[model samples]
Target chain A: MQRRLFLQGMLGVVAATRLPASTLLPLMLNGCQREPLLPGTLLSACDDARGNHFVASIQPDGSLGFQIPVPLRAHDSCASKQRDRALFFARRPGRQIYVVDLHERLLIQTIDAEPGRHFYGHGVISADGQWLFTTEQIYATGQGMIGVYRMSQPIRRETEFSSHGMDPHQLQWLSDGETLVIANGGILTHPDQNRENLNPDTMQPALTYVRVRDGALLESHQPPHHQMSLHHLDVSAQDQVVVGVQHQGALTDAVALVGSHRRGSDMQWWMADELTQLRMQQYTASVAVDANGGQAVVSCPRGNGIAVWDMQTGQLINMLDIADAAGVRRQPQQSGWVGTNGAGALVRIDSSGTATALQTLRQYPLRWDNHATLI
Target chain B: MKPRFVRKSRYEKKNRYVRKKMQLLLLIVALLSLAACNDDMTPGQRWLATTTEQIRQGYQQLSAQTRAQQQMADAFCQQPDAQGLQTMQAAWRESMASWQHMQWLRMGPIAQDNDDWKLQFWPDKKNILQRKMQDILEGSEPVSADSLVHASVVVQGFSAQELLLFDPQFATVEKFAGRQCDLLRASTTLTARVGQKLADAWQDETWLKRWVAPTATQAGLTPAHVRNGEILDALLAQIERIKNDKLGEPMGLKTRDKKPNGYFAESWRSENSLANLQNNLLAVQQLIRPAQGYGLFQYLKDSQQQALADEMVIKLDNAQQALQQIHPPLTSAVTDAAQQPALQNAHRALGELATFCKQKLAPALGLTLGFNSNDGD
Candidate 1:
């Protein structure tokens, strides 16, 4: 009789608390009983930031792979190989792109981009491998733009696209095949002064989509919420989009929506877009969509956690605190990473929510602008 | 059948609920522990605390005395004066005494009973000399040349003072007294040998012979090639006197010579009386620039000992510059040599090197004057 009463009391407390699932699911995922479906797996990681150029592969069993030399200096990041040709970017001297032969891993040609122009540096290649898109920040006038480079031509032709907002950082490709999505990271500037000139009072954040069938912008989408500067974005196999936002401190910004597109007409923002105001201090630096597009993960480096959202439920499912989430990446055998920033690390999260770290990447301590791309 | 079935169902339901609650509590505890254990820590602090203190202590235990001795040597080298030279010689003796003792300590009994005589004579060398004295007491005087040769091994480890103090044939008063020119010559040779050994340690041999001759007794003699002719006559004539003496003469043999004033002076002047001999002996005594390790006679190898001299000169110049930077510079009166722009700069630099060697490196290395000097005397 006494044990029954005790059990009843516990149930009563849980029901009355109405505690959020997000506050509890993280505990379950990070606990020992939650066995990783693919434990100790590895992946390839590379940091093409500095003059350091090397590739590290993590095996399926979590063993570190030998470092393979990639003949490029300060590779910002790498892109998927197109017809045995891979593309990488470097910053020393000036911002430029190099096309490399994947088998030989050697640069065969270089295309110089805008010199003396400050580039925010994250870029992605088109699925057909005919286009390369990168972000550019013009410090002189505090204006930012998207650079669309045509790689199909004998000489790479660059077409400048103005960022819907300032300080664009990364871009993603939509399943529609004709649309290119971008994160216009809202960062203002004053070169005449220092970074101290960032006007938090007058910053706008937006996520843009451009219809580019033959390389051009079409339509776009914005959360009608407030200015939550989206910094990085990724797409899942199921076509769900994950966006990380650096919100300008305001009560309305915190309520930005994140979810999957159920249909062209039913595609609406997450309902959480109305809870409270968002602050820049709560901004995140990384975000990725799960392989199946059922989940989205956003990393708050300062929070040391990856905030997970369930697209199916339109609910914030979990937040995995990995101590150093800034260095974390999605792996096939695990849901989150525990690594360092600017360190080369490749991670993949599979359909079963298993993260597999491809390999440990060497910190390419180069002297230039750097970014990463999916290979 | 109905009552039994109902009772069993109730028990199963209670067990299931209890198990669920227990599982939930365990899960919560596990989560809390995981969160606690994953706390972050700052890096580069592990090796900071103890290693830094150890490095500081290592630096503090340096030998300052040897550095001071180097300074004294530099001073002697620069001044080439009687007192500076004597001080250096004394310091050399002190260093040799300590070094020999240190070797004795380091070798312990391993250096004893090594029938190889050379090796055995290292630590118990004093005993070897004592043995020789014992033999002498048993009517074995002058210790045989073979035994003397064996004793030389012990002598190799002797300090300068020990070499001078160890008198075999009661020659201490005769050979080292005011009239004992042979001991004076021997002393001069030992002083030079100390400097030579220092050079040898530095792997410099070209100038070693000039500093220390093969025979310690032969080093202080006048150059065998010096001629007494018109030049000698002119020098002697200026004195308005005549003297007589022979190198191979007996102790009392003498010839008298008279001056124009009819004053008759003794034929052989006392060892203390011959001004030239005394002056030469004093010069040789004052020239005892004893060095240690690879540091002695370091100046001699310089394109004229240019390396060592330049080191001394440069350091002194820096020190002078440093001194000048002081609000009120060091109150050193500028000498005539220092008045010349170049010489002045050189002297100032040399002085700084001298002070640095003496105050810093000497004690740092635990090196002193003749760490292993006094051999072959």
Candidate 2:
């Protein structure tokens, strides 16, 4: 009888707060029986108008579920399949990582980067969900290191390995789950020198596949252009990798910004028409592939648009206009994609190339960051 | 086989109705309380509304001054007398001062459409303005509204007008003979038109409302506090620019030769650099603590940041006082070794204000510099 009264009191509080019925339903159930909360469809980092950073959970329909503030600016987040938790990594040259328990809707722990090391804003959890791999930079020598962590109660850094290139950015697991494909964005930078690209003229970016168990380089592939700094990537269930590159060359030079790569094979460059290329402004912020592995979308924040490509033919399919659009992720149950922008717009693009604004989600004036991930 | 039926008591029915009435009353009270909470304005929101009004007034003042400048220029061209020229110069100075008041708030429409640079292009290390103006004078380019619209921005604004009216080579009546007079008239006309457009743009009620209460669908999510930070940044940037680039460069602090460079000072030919800096300080003062109204200082105090508010006001006063000690014709003063002490004091005071804003107030306000504007690559 006491427990029932306590549950009633909690329900009254939730009702007074005017929380959404869906959110209240979970709370009510958990009050009666302690059950783990279900994961949401989308997650992204955001900065409120006052410059406070937060990890926001978004519903499948793009409504906001909840937000947990972080002390520093967060770049990207990866959800864990083995545990009801997610990891938020700080941007490059930043030394903080936040571990959030999704079920509890709370930050569990904060892990500081080792001295003389910083994260590059991308990571992947193993298929078994026991290991978390993060791309880091050895600031002293400008080398890339893949830091491996054991996902125990207290996350522990088990070991690390050289990423076989400089400035390794985003990485993902292969179908076999043992091989990790990494995008070594060849731009070299040091925290002391600010964000100056020290090796612009000598950059040689490449895609390298490495063995996670032994840290051995299994295969490496380079694009035709030497100045294309491969930055972000997304892998399909079929093991197809779509890479997005930010050009470090002259602005006048029009180069391919998207490429497709497979293990033991050369990368194929995908180019839009000349006018479309000019519209892209030579920068691709994020990339995501549909569940079917047939269509890939790349966000161009500078251009304020997103370009969809036919993965099979390497041809431009469609381009959707979105102001300051950056973050994008494929929907879990559908063939469509959802994108967010610095303008605080949330849009879902259907397979038929129709874009619909998620009005309820866009009601809050929060600027979403460069990347959003699916949970 | 007939069944007997029981009827409910009238008191029981009445009690049910009473309970229902009580529940409805509770819901209505809850809704009214929620509405009251929603209607109350946050301190940040109030600050935004006040700042918007300040900006509108500033731009309206600019429009009026520029219109007067155009008329004075026309009068001088028609008479070509000494008195007429002097009146025109005074009018031009007033107009430029007004522009300086709005220069620090460099975003929004002013930042777009290349209007920011068109108003004033600074740090001309290569004297591109002179070269561009000379090319226009030597060529057969028609000096009209249409042609000037396509002309280089450096030749169509206040700096170009200053060159023609103050520089020794072009100050005489003979220099205003044919095409030069047309150019001067066209430049002043364009300047007035630009000013009026800026004023009209700021007068939009819809834009002001959205700016004060922005939603996510807006092109740039400008929340009230973010707007507060923007104003703070602009205030700090203006003071810093005055201390570092405007004064420091001419004072030899930023130069390799370690000697004063008179040519580096803004409005050097007109000898109004000190006057411009004084007007900039006045503008800063108006933003901090405007007379007859509340300003950012009041907002900060209301937010429980009285210490920071007091520091800003005190430092602003100190900088203004220091600036008063420095005489006009800042170019000559920087070059004169005897006036070095006064110049150094002014620089130090202004530098203190800039440092306080950047180090103390920005953090207190929860603002970060160059995070959004700078390229993140």
Candidate 3:
């Protein structure tokens, strides 16, 4: 092979059309900064807007590899528990899914998707690695749907069930066994963007459960707060669900709610939406259940702390301040989630909420790299 | 008498007045011509002075350029990025220690020719791996947020772009070819480091054994596992003697002028065919190979087993051919030509493999033993 070809294959190549010198200088300087690590290095991670191209990995000795760069625009990512792979989904305007081989570090394969008539949210892969499900925030032709992909084959099966309302932000299987209960945090959007002219009187944000074997959209329950953008979610071992809300403008609390399915309808709301939103700012990227799921963690990027929630009781257990933290990760072994505090050093958040010091990577402050590894 | 005198005086006076007016006109024409010539001379003098100044400025610019080039040369000799390549080369040796633990790179269950026959497999494996081991055989693809990308992005804004675009050379370096040049610069450093190693290896013939370490590890055997360490050590000694006698020894660089033979030149560019092939193999090998999960020997089907045996025989023949090709006078020349292509390829391919294994492959394997993930980025 020629040197150019070898280089093209070895590193990465982009179009080389010349730009003005002013445009190129900063990129040269930016190349000096190393990438940041995402949180939950082992359990797997996923986030909103199909930012799935973001992938992070870490060694047992604390060596961090952050944000697997993608050719296309990625909105969210989901790490798989059964394999050393990250599934990334592109955002609206495109439907290309990139699969990063955590072992190889290169982009192993890509699943071409057509977001032809819908917008997408964060997605998740099954523990068995058989199924991959994601929420279609807006379905132009049909009611809001959850698209299901069979990993072994190229075919896709969409569950055309009304999300009880509009946009479903995050999707996950609630329990391990036969029933497939998904936390469908609901809001409605235009088929292309998030500009949903929701009727304040009729609009409701819901959590819906589905039975996978039968493809039944069994039950739907709305959250008490209509304005909360309940987009991120994680399920615990005992079937408790931990959810984080990205409050829309004017809403006070960016809440974390814990509850389980009761009978058919969503019941026993021990943790209702807390009025925690200060100045209506914090954008919650992710929420995760620990290895045991006894405790849950939330990423408050604006506050620079991973707010811990007690699973048994619906209460804010503690807020691990990451103001000095650069890239804060929970579940460092499974989901290597990372955050930036406008600084260089990465603050590592282990699965147990123990924060530790990370190395100074680059000048650029870290951002959430969609999903982290589930080693 | 009075009439005659008046007529003569009047005639003489009229003649004198006509002569004086003609002389005054002549004087005015002369002054006009002189003024015209002086105006033309002003332009001529200005042109001559401007040309001289330009030439002087050009000479000074050329001098400055030469001085800058010299400074660049000096800095390039000791720059961190330059020395970094050498550090990477040395780091390669340490990386080999980890490869020794890998079972696949060890000696095959069936051994023939040399006891350390496993060492020869890397040359063969390089042929087989294609595209699959990219992560293992190559470093992580450059990330988007890298300095190269950011520098380019920064130029898109107004002020810097306008200023840089005005200067063609600086603009090209900044916008058009900055990132690529940076990468190439890094690669050149890496090449020099590897070249240094090759130079030392030429001095010591036992260098081939070290190069074969990865190949040996691929075969599932090691120096400790081999039956007699003493016999292998003696063979290494013999190899070393042949290498030393044939290649001579490195006497620093001071006595280079007196040496009869010169094995190295300033720069040599190859098709990189060998390096490319090795990279291909490493990429495939580094992937989640089905054979790797179990031992390569154990997973070998009946047909694969026969193929392995046949390949081993071919390798032995090649080794024999290599040994026979060695002659006292022609050894260095032949070795230079034969080894240059393969060594360059091997070193580069190994560098890629080491990086991939460390970055992506190991993490995928879930071997991260309490190491913090955030620090690596």
Candidate 4:
């Protein structure tokens, strides 16, 4: 019930009630101004009409909250355990991570990658919020590294561990919290090459599970096809992982691009109807499991559709036509999902296969980026 | 040397000249600003609006032809004669021709609910259609249009009807004793119903609004830019399919070490594979330079790339002409060595056209095709 309340609160909380900047000046001087938990329901890296990059926040009601400008475009973001702040990481080849203090509605810190490392544009905070783990790669060798940071006074980088694969992109927390499940995309790319896949023919992608406390490799499994690069995923309360694949081969290669794996089991791929497969187009942007873990939703931005699957049976339940679908996440107060598209529309997705525009989403001249995070 | 009165007049004349110049400058600025904020459709936008209308009309034709086909099938089933069989096949071909003309390059109401596939399912490499159709014919229950609503896509639409009408084993009126007529009437009825649904779907104004204006301005995105790129992408993509799947695959150019396999060809049972390929290219030609209104051809001309537009249309013309030069019954044509060069020329023309679209047309329009839609994470 409390979690539901938290989700509902994210949708709207009267942004007009925010204290004026003048009233908070004295508190800032004292260096002790802590406000509410992250002030918005949805957080994403967006670009404005003028092409300026920003780490933006929007309420459940689709009202704009904060737009913290950043130097480079960022990717997926994860809220801190305390919910007081959130971190947005720059995409590969970028070494900066922007930290936004939700209460102050300001970008409080910019964390730089260790001298020789760069981020893969994804990260997750521990359940207790003690540590922040990020996907990164050693620049010179193209080796994947998991950069661990102790969430201390200055948020310093403590150490790192090998990702056990190449081009690790997005990671999620298992039910145990300390166990991180990562999608090792396995495509070798150099930062200087401008996002080129240097080893497509030889790439080996995998879904891997690693222990954060000791950096131990618990389990690892490669995709059925060597060219099936696993990129983004989300884990449920049952530790069931749903991952989205980006195939680096012919478009007509009819391989399943979304699948699930529970530890110690073979991966179960979700197959859509043949027509739906045509719409999926072999690329997926995000994978989100609903609050109940009974359903999995994947946004196929390339195909401009969203597909939902029955978690237990791994069968497709519904396909929603959403043009340029960017990200999907479960609603704060219910079983359905909220999806954002590239056309600047927010759509509410019901498990019954009906997709409707979120009527209250205030129109903005902004394109929602590839991923969305909840505060 | 002039008098004081003459000097004053000269100064007045200079003042008048300066005022006139300033007014002309102001007028030019006002006109430029209007151009910047012009609500008038760009050449690309005009093409999209025109194409949308064209798509609606095409769907209407499909609905009408399919309805006529359903009626013709019922008439033939009641009479069961050779003449009736010929008439029924002609109606089926016309309906299929209408469908081939649609060539939806992207999403719309027809694409939203799997409606398009319910109307026609093709490229059956595994012969799922025949297997399912035979199973249905061998079943206990009497097949009807309502029953097919929930049936597998394999036994539905034009492909199933083709098996019933054209395949030698199923084509005879004597086969009606085994419920062949029932399957034909049911499949044709279902086809007509789905076609009508597609036509109805295209009438929604809300859908049209979303289809045309697709992206946010943060990327300098506009309706014309998005729709025009998709049209070009779809045209190029379908032509590639025709060159490869429809023509090359059956020719064994990409499979079985160059041994021609006629069974792989679409509409092989009906022996209309070559005709289908021609219709597909005709649809591509219509989109590139429609008979009426501003098409992609006009858009190209506005961008000062008329030569590129002409090259694409010319290439498509060459492809269709080459395809037409081949013999009937694509199933046998693939095995006839004499027809191989024509097939190869047609295939080469299609490949070159697709390359021109991707390389030349895209840049000339100041658009990058499939940036967000096809970009992988």
Candidate 5:
């Protein structure tokens, strides 16, 4: 009964958020039953306008299911198929992962950085959901390390691998599940300085493919420009990887901030027209590939727009405008992707250049973080 | 058929009626609360609305100046006298001042279609304007509004006109003989059209509404705090460009050997670089503390940071005075050691203003620098 009452209070907050399904959600996800809450279509780490952080679940029908307050702001999240669990990793320089028990609809456990190690705020679960690989760096040395953990022993870091470069972030597994592709942002940072690029001129950002078993660097490729920080990436079923770049140099630099890569070939640079490039402002927040593997969506938050690419042709197919646009993920039931912005907007961006407003919680005013997890 | 079922059905109908009444009451209460929320605008909200209006006014000034600029160009083309050239130059200066003031707006319609570049192309390190102008002049193709519609942006804007009207090689009465006149008319016509379109985009009060209470579709009305963060970024970026690109690079501050390059200075041919810089500063000053509006100054005062706001004013004034004191063209000043101190002082003043805005004013207003746009992975 106490748990039910707690859930009822949570439902109240979610309803007050007034997501797209504002009218029906208060009654739909009332959280009064003893049964575990069903998984939602999307899971994200969100922040409200008043500076409150939450691990939020967006229901399949496009309504707010639940939002649990967290002490720290999380970056990216991943769900485990082995059990009803989802882990939200704290952003860079952060040390903990909030483990949410889907069945109990509660934070089940917290994973801390082992001593001097801090997470880069992104990780990928194994295909069977048994093993977890997280991007980490030695806080003092600024060396990239991929921390591995077994789902059964969730709280402990079992092993580590060299990420082949510094500032490893946003890794994804290939279809074989034994290979991990890491976007080594190539900039060194200390927790004390707080995200300042300590080695801007010398940083060597790369796309590194590693053998998960032995932590061997299988292959690595660098961006055309050394200052381009390859930060976030998404892997398709066909082993195609799409990476987003954040240039540490001038915003007007003509560097392509989006690239696609195959294992044995050179990276393919994708760019928009000159005007589009100027609006993109040389920065991209997140990159997401659709389920079918023929299209990719990259969120250009600085540009206040999102660009969809035809993966087959390496061409920009559509550019949809959204204010502070970020955290785009493939639509579960369609080829389009859902995006969120800082102004509490959930937008549906289709490949055909159609953008549909799915939900807006402007008054409750949540700024969804850069990346969203399709649960 | 059962007696209990017949009684339950009647009870259900009565319950339904009561539920409908409750919903109606709830909706009315909800709407009243929303109305109450909208009654008094927060200081930040008021500032945004005022800023929106200021933006519209700024664009209007730009359009008017460009239209006048086109007229002057046409007048010069018809007569081609020294006095006519001077008048046309004055009009171009007026248009540039207004354009510089509004150049910091890198969003909405101006940036959406890159009309800003169409109005003025800067940092032309490769001398594309001179090359393109010579090419067009040498070519037999007719220059007109329709012909120049799809012309290279380098030749379609202020930079090309500046070169043609100011450079000694091109700015002569003899140079305005035929083709150059056609080029000037064509370019100014294009610029006026672009400026008018921008002004028209913001002519209505709907932009203000969209800016503050925007629907998710049209990309306006970001939370005031977040929008302020970007605005602050735009201000700082403009300052950086002015300090770094406009002055620092030409002054040899950015070079390894510290050798001044007069040719690199923008508007060096006409020696109007300092004048342009001054106009940009004046525009920034107006944006911060308009004569009558709830801008950054009033917003700061509302937030009880009057002292900080006053300091910003003092810094801006100091920079403006220092720059004005440099009597020579920025090209000469960049190379003259005698003018170095004044340039350094003005640069320092700009740095202080930017620092104060980013550190003191931003925090005072609850805006954080290097948020998502800067720090996002």
Candidate 6:
């Protein structure tokens, strides 16, 4: 698949009609348009005007690679290393899941949650790419459950186990690839009650680690504030877990929104200075760690700003403004990270904290969702 | 000097002066003719003109209704009689329905200053208005226009007035005398003041100029296309809000249990939830395709999207018809078993209308709905 796309890209260069060889010579001599397109893919769920949801693959240079329509709105997606397929989870309280084959640019399978269960909009693929783990909720009991599926031609649900917490949202595989870290957003919601948080006052959010082999509870940690629902997370190569929180408390309260945690260690909450914290509005939509694992960035859609932090030092690096920005992902093999927003903007932030807008993809009409994964 | 040469030079100079004067006269005539034709106005400008006129008319109606409401409340306060109370209730309903007409114009001045919420604080999901009204009525918070300005927003708007006029506990003359009457008078007066201010704001000539000539502003709305796109987006947004939040929530189409929640309905206490929706749809229709003049529909037709415009008009008509079938007191219709089907049908019609506005109208107009804060988690 990669080879075919490469050949096609080369053909595009050779067949350029607007720029003749005479003009191309001067352009090449000036080293303009010389940067080649990045060699990787990024996947996101985009909503069209017709109410259809699509899992769209974007190339590194922000050009669209492929798009396959899904039955419902999708949130975060996980890519498989052993195959050319990716799993797109339905938005919270939705029951449908779609598996798409990027190589063929088609949906290969559809999985529906068992009765009385619904997805939390996030999932993770196992290291060997043989199994997929999804965070689900038993609506009747408000219990978090993990549904394991064997990744095969006709994907089969292998087994299920407790998530050891309630309302488990985004989860990631640990560096060891044997343990999974889940951000158990403690807000109690039932399908019967719609999207209302039923237990905001007494919510108990936690970050839990469990063994994928047997679903054993390895550890669990919670922030001091109960109303801070840890909903999104990304693990670094150094096994550092950076979590983004959504606050359910009063709007007047000032609380930390980004936290860093390591297994068996207390979760340390780091916040921007007082002004920046106030600007965050107590919500972090998405989080991403650089490829080197030394820095992390969080996108605050409410504040319209992205904050970069040194994961090791746990100090604020800088904050840059982008309107309605949410999705954040590390650029493949680069120290910088790329972010997308609801205003149809694609921006790149280098390791030095300089942000540049990639103008090519800014014209796409769809509002990018919460997470974009680099494949 | 020779007499013949001098005479010839003077005649040539006179001829040159007369020609310059004639040229200036022709230039002035041409300018006047161009101004008369109004050929500089684009389709978007024409649509904006119609929209602003409708907004101005809607706000003026609200002002009149609110002023009448205030006067009726004053009369009731002075008489303290059953007849006066009935008149006050009638006036309150009229004022509320008038306010509903202006709800769709949720941009510019109305959008600024939290005027929408100040005019009506809705979805009182937790009965905040009730709780706050009770507290203020029992406490010694001065019940005057000045005090109500800083009072809880929940207790200063239409919903608060609805409770005083319709709720069983506060409807009677004896139950609503003294401070309660004062609160009613004060709330109504505040609404009237706000309504007048809104109307006056729209009357500003500069605002109208800026709105109609969006490209002339420094907001970087460079081309007329960008300006038209924003107008289209705002129009569709109001329709979406009407279908999704105003109607869908009360009808239980958006709730989790799929069971009707009457308390979620707007103006439920006054049994005017459906009336509010009807007025909202009326505003939408008038703004899109006014009866006697050019509007968004005409703009689309001028842009060579006649089929899309025609389909939108049909969908909007269907929605209006469906709404007419539902009875008053939408609160009861949503929760009542027998009336559920009609409510569902009305919801479906409105949903289709909203879909057409979003999918068909937006794309044809080259408009995109920007990121709303409430779209996702």
Residue range B1-377, candidate 3, lDDT tens digits: 46764655677787985775445333333332343344332221222222222222322332333233323323443443534433422332222222221212111111111111111112111112122222211444552213222222112111121222222332233332333223323322322332233223222324222221211111222321121111122222222222232222211111224242322210001112222222223322322122222221222222244454343334333433443343322314324555444333333333433333334322232111111111111
Docking quality class, candidate 3:
incorrect
Q: How do all the candidates rank in terms of TM-score, highest first?
A: 5, 4, 6, 2, 3, 1
Residue A165 CA displacement from its true place in model 5, Å:
4.8
lDDT of 2 by residue, A1-375 (tens): 453233223212222234567655755665432333333346777776556788886654344656889987887888887436778888887788888877677888898888899998788889988999999999999999999998888788889998988999999888899999999998889988766688877887989999988999998887677889999898898999999988876443658999998776778899987446655657888899988898888888755578888888898887666545668888765566777776456666655433422221353466678888766
* True-vs-predicted CA distance for residue B202, candidate 6, Å: 5.3
Q: Report each candidate's C-alpha RMSD, comma-separated, in the order given.
A: 36.9, 15.3, 33.9, 14.9, 13.4, 12.5
lDDT of 6 by residue, B138-202 (tens): 98767799998887666777988999999987888897768999999999988999899998876
Q: Give TM-score values for chain A, per-prediction.
A: 0.62, 0.88, 0.67, 0.89, 0.87, 0.87
lDDT of 2 by residue, B45-109 (tens): 55565566678778988999999888877777786767776777888899999998887776566
Regions more than 4 Å wrong, model 2: A1-73, A81-83, A106-115, A124-135, A144-374, B1-49, B72-92, B107-114, B122-143, B151-156, B159-184, B211-213, B216-278, B300-308, B319-371, B374-377
Tens-digit lDDT track of model 1 for B264-284: 111111111122222222221
Worst 10 residues of 5 chain A by lDDT: A7-16
lDDT for each candidate structure: 0.37, 0.75, 0.38, 0.76, 0.76, 0.75
Candidate 4: where are CA atoms >4 Å away? A1-170, A183-207, A212-231, A245-284, A290-295, A301-303, A308-318, A329-375, B1-45, B79-86, B203-264, B302-348, B358-377
lDDT tens digits by residue: candidate 4, B125-214:
677777788898889987888998778766788888999999897898798655888889899999998889887776655555565665
TM-score of predicted chain B versus true chain B for each candidate: 0.20, 0.84, 0.18, 0.86, 0.85, 0.85
DockQ metric for all predictions: 0.00, 0.07, 0.01, 0.13, 0.10, 0.15
| CA shift of A117, model 3, Å | 3.6
Q: For every candidate, what share of the true interface contacts is present? A: 0.00, 0.07, 0.00, 0.17, 0.10, 0.17
iRMSD per model? Answer: 37.0, 7.3, 24.8, 6.3, 5.5, 7.1
lDDT of 3: 0.38
